[model samples]
Target: MGVIAMDKKQITLYYSSENSIGKQLNAYVESSGKDHLTIDISKTNVTGTQWAELADGLNKNISDLVNTDHPDFKEAYGENSVDLDDDGWLKILNKNPSLLKNAIVIKGKDFIELTSASDFKQYMDPDSAGIEKPY
Candidate 1:
């Protein structure tokens, strides 16, 4: 069978339950009252190809998807970890899903790295995204 493609009309969330930011992001996503998909990498196993696709969709590299500053990453790879190739990075993510730096939200063609719980709110209503419209 062919690979399953992401639904352009659905909002997809990639997050780790073990991460606080991911947990917070979930709250916002769930309450949005919109069609969405939530993937908890903590309990589920995400494939290397899937992780790579997410990174690519987010306009980032595999390494960028990892929170290198996280304690777990630092403990396992050291304070200053060595660089690895694309495949190597994907392997790291597939094996250690907790290394995800932040919650990623994808709505249609829009891909956003949810920096905060409310970050996804902007996508819901782009016109009133905390802009004062002082002009």
Candidate 2:
């Protein structure tokens, strides 16, 4: 039989220069031998459509993506107030990208947000996605 090659899934990492953790996550992904492109959301303007798509990929609500602790968030919505929908949160993120959560990974059709370094292991697991591991 002839040799067969499975197409590799594409990986895109969204990071920010201001966030040291995000920079570390980018390095970790690279060292893990995964092929990916890095986009600095702080530098690049992310469109609402892209944000919506990412939200869809992770099956995440926009409120889940918001950094509630961010100053912008606190200033806009006081600690006790709770009356914002997903679209409203998305709009806040679009206007204040700094209020966005960090280290978003887009692998093929899968969208993920890595809050910690260990989360990368989930993607490396074969049962999870049959993705290649660095070690």
Candidate 3:
């Protein structure tokens, strides 16, 4: 049997307010010869189930691939970290493990932060909010 090499897949979720940033990012990615999947939280009736399904699909798609470090990640998350108080956002983040690095949390008109998969899991829950202290 021969060893198989999987392509590294990049996933980005743009949760921008007014739908501007997300749209622009989508276009930019597409023009750059990279395809991306998007979920419009503002237009879609994105229930917990829908979010779960999206997360599951993304996880399955990238299961065997590595992540390429891109400047977009830093741009989305910023050089420093952020603090959040919304339980709904926390719940969504905690439940979607695949969304770690690719996922971004936008609060109204502001981008909360970008998180690593591990850090995302650690500080995402309301109960785990204390983890934000170190950052």
lDDT of 1 by residue, 1-135 (tens): 213255666778989888788898888888878778898988877787777777787788888998888887888889876689988887777778888888888765556787777676665665865421222
Tens digits of per-residue lDDT for model 3 on 24-120? 5444444544333444444444454444433344443221111123344335545554333334443434443322334443222222333333433
Candidate lDDT scores, in order, read 0.77, 0.69, 0.37
* TM-score, structure 2 vs. true: 0.72
Candidate 3: count the clashes: 1
- Predicted structure with the largest TM-score when compared to the true one: 1
Candidate number achieving the greatest lDDT relative to the actual structure:
1
Off by over 4 Å in 3: 1-7, 49-135
* Candidate number with the higher lDDT (2 or 3): 2
Q: Order the candidate numbers by TM-score, best to worst.
A: 1, 2, 3
lDDT comparing candidate 2 with the true structure: 0.69
**Model 1 misplacement above 4 A:** 1-4, 129-135
Provide the lDDT at 34 for model 3.
36
RMSD, every candidate, angstroms:
4.3, 6.7, 16.7
